[model samples]
Target: MHLSIIAGSSGLVGNNILNQLCEDNHNVIAINRKPISGLHPKTTELVIDFESFLIDGSLPACNHAFICLGTTMKIAGNKNNFRRVDFDYSLDIAKKAFESGAKKLTLISSGGADSSSKNFYLRVKGELEDAIINIGFESVNIFRPGFLTGAGGRKRATSEKIFMKLAKFLDLILIGSARKYRSINAEVLARKMVSTLKSKPGVNYYYYDDFIK
Candidate 1:
C-alpha cells in the first residue's frame, strides 16, 4: 500500500487531501498544530508546534509528502510571522521529510508566485518553491491555484470574498494562459494531487486550469 505524510492537515486543501488519501486506502500521517478529529483508520495524527518541531527517526517514512502549510499576513499579525509559517516552517518539514526518505514532494503555492515579484506574498511563495526544489526531491509538483473555493468553516477577508466574486464573473472570459488564474474547489485540487503521484517522475507544475483537467 502507498503511504504519504501531509503537513497542515487542518487547512482546507490539506484536510481534503487527507480524506482523499484515506478513501483511496492509502496510509496517511497527518502533521498538524493540534490533533485532527474523526481521523480515518489509516490516518495517524501528529501534533506539534511548527516553530519547535524537530526532525527525528520518529517521523514515518513515506513515498510522498505534501506541504500545505500557509498563513495570511493579517492572521499572522505581521509580515515576519507570515513568512515564518509560509516559508520557514514549511521548508523545515520539507527538509525533514526528504531526509526521512520521501521521494516525491507536492506544495500548494499560489497563482502569482514569482521570486522577483514586488508583492511580498507572491515573492515569499516563489522563494519557498525555489528552496524546496533545491532540496532535491526525486519528483517535485508545485500547484499554483488561484482563489480556492471550498467550505472549511474559516472566515475569509473582505478582499478575498470580493476577489472570489470577480473571479466567477470573469470565468467565462478567461482563456489560454489566463485560465491559469481561474478559481477551483479545494477538493478538486486535493484529489488531483493525490491521484497524480504514480505519474511520470519529474518536476511538474500545475496551475488553476491544470487541476480542472
Candidate 2:
C-alpha cells in the first residue's frame, strides 16, 4: 500500500516507522524539515520548512498517513514553538493529506492526553487529538505510548532522563492503573501503528500498555 508519513524520520517512533514501512515494501513518502539519510529505495524524503510548507496541490497519492511530529519544551525552548511543532504542524499535514485523498490517519500522542488536563503537555496533545478528529477523517488511530524508549535526534532534558531511568523500575509495578507508567520501545510502537493501518478502518484509541500489547 502507498503511505505518506509526516515527521517519522527524526524522532525514534517516526524513524523506526519509516524503516519498517520500507521493509514491508510499501511506497512511503517522508515529509520533514531536513533530508533523511540512508533510506530504502521505496522511501522518498521531502524537505521543506514546516512553517511555510505549501501543500499547493502537490502531494503524492496515498492510502494512509501517519502523523508522528512532536517536540519537547526543552528542545523547543519555548512553549509556543513547542506547540507549533507538536500540534500545528501535525494538524496542517493531516489536513493536507486528507485533502489529497488519504483516508486513514495514525497519530502518536502522549499517555495522559486530556483536553482538561492540568499538565500542559497532555493538554496540548489532547487538544490536538480533538482537532484532528474534528477534521473528518474516515479512520483515525491514536496511539498514546508512555516513556518512549528509543534513540532519536532529540535528547531529553536531564530531569526527564533521570525520571526515565527511575520509571524503568516503577513501570513493572504500576501495570494497570490510570496513572500507570509503562515504557514502550519505539520500534514496537512503529510496528503496531503500521499494523493497525493495514488491518482495518476504524476510530481506535490506544493507551500506553495497549500500544505495546
- Expressed as tens digits, the lDDT of each residue in 1-213 for candidate 1 is 577999998898998999888888989999988776789999988888765674342467788899999988889999999999999989988998898898999999999999899999999999999999999999999999987877662578788778767778877777887888878989999988887677557778988767977
Local distance difference test values of all predictions, in order: 0.86, 0.80
Poorly placed runs, candidate 2 (over 4 Å): 54-58, 155-161
Per model, state how many residue pairs clash: 0, 1
- Among these predictions, the greatest TM-score belongs to 1
Residue 150's lDDT in candidate 2? 63
Task: Output the lDDT of residue 159, model 2.
Answer: 83
Predicted structure 2: lDDT: 0.80
